[model samples]
Target: MIFIHPTAEVSDKAKIGDGTKIWHHAQIRENAEIGENCNIGKGVYIDFGVKIGNNCKIQNYVSVYHGVVIEDDVFIGPSVTFTNDLYPRAFIWSEEKVSKTLIKKGASIGANSTLICGITIGKFALIGAGSVVTKDVPDYALVYGNPAKITCFVCECGRKLENFEDNKKDNLVKGICKFCKKEIFINKNNFKKWKK
Candidate 1:
């Protein structure tokens, strides 16, 4: 039961899973694989060979370039741009120069963000609007800003955690969500890697 809008250009070589809907003017390139029950909004561009997992929502005009892999339950907001090349020259382009990006399951990327290539966005991470993510983000991190830094850790429900404390013995940072009352733990080493 996949639905593709009449104005959308979906290549026959692309594989769209069941219950997916591609909206007006969207383009899904050759060999791209979009998993089940995904919503691709108007004017979105999914580049060749890109892989998107199940139940993802990609908002209008978002550009997912080649070599980007998005896991299940990801939310990519409007106008988000994913880059595949570290160096860009109009006349110098080759597939070998394309760097890969991995957005782990359950991550939310806010509107108008730009993600540089070769970075792995961790599971359940929340990226704020207008962010420019230049490096890897830790799991459950809340990141925002020009070079998106981890401000805090969030619960799986996307609620900010409170009463953050580090346990030196185990090298873990622990926080509890006020709303969900869920205990979240992040490895100290991984937290330190992106805390800047």
Candidate 2:
């Protein structure tokens, strides 16, 4: 049930899973692995060595650069940009230890967020639109702004859930991850997060 458009250029080395749909003008580069039921929108550029998991949604004009490993059911919003170089240099291979950015399962990134390399965004974490992520984000944490900070805890239901931040007892919430406390919200329609 794959729906790849004719205008799109998919490399032979790329592995596209069943039920995946590559839209108009989208390009999946060599060695890119897209999982089942994923919807790659128009003008999306999936770079080499990038791996996307099942049921993911990548919107228009987004760049999934090399060394990015996106887990299952993640939602990448429109115009989202992922940077692979920490301190980019034209003359040298000075990535400055630019490690890979790992997005765990069920995370939802808002439109136009910029993810800096070497940062591991926690599972089920919600990154707000237009954020510049610099460091590691915890799971189930709702973050925003230039150097993305935790503002609230988001439920898997797309509601702003209660935060046990002030609680003296350290206990795990049901359906949420241990680090971020993000609930396991699988996308209903096609793996994209719905704005509540």
Candidate 1 lDDT tens digits, 1-196: 9999999999999999999999999999999999999999999999999999999999999999999999999999999999999999999999999999999999999999999999999999999999999999989999999989988889999999888788878989898999999998998887776565
Highest TM-score scorer: 1
Per-model TM-score versus the true fold: 0.95, 0.82
Report the error of model 1 at residue 97, Å.
0.1
**How many angstroms is residue 173 displaced in model 2 relative to the true structure, after the best TM-score fit?**
6.8
lDDT of 2: 0.82
Question: What ranges in model 2 sit over 4 Å off?
Answer: 94-98, 163-196
- The TM-score that candidate 1 achieves is 0.95
Tens-digit lDDT string for candidate 2 (110-140): 9999999888877778999999999887776
* Candidate 2 colliding pairs: 139-180, 140-180, 140-182
Relative to the true structure, candidate 1 has a C-alpha RMSD (angstroms) of: 1.5
Query: Cα deviation of 1 in candidate 1 (Å)?
Result: 1.1
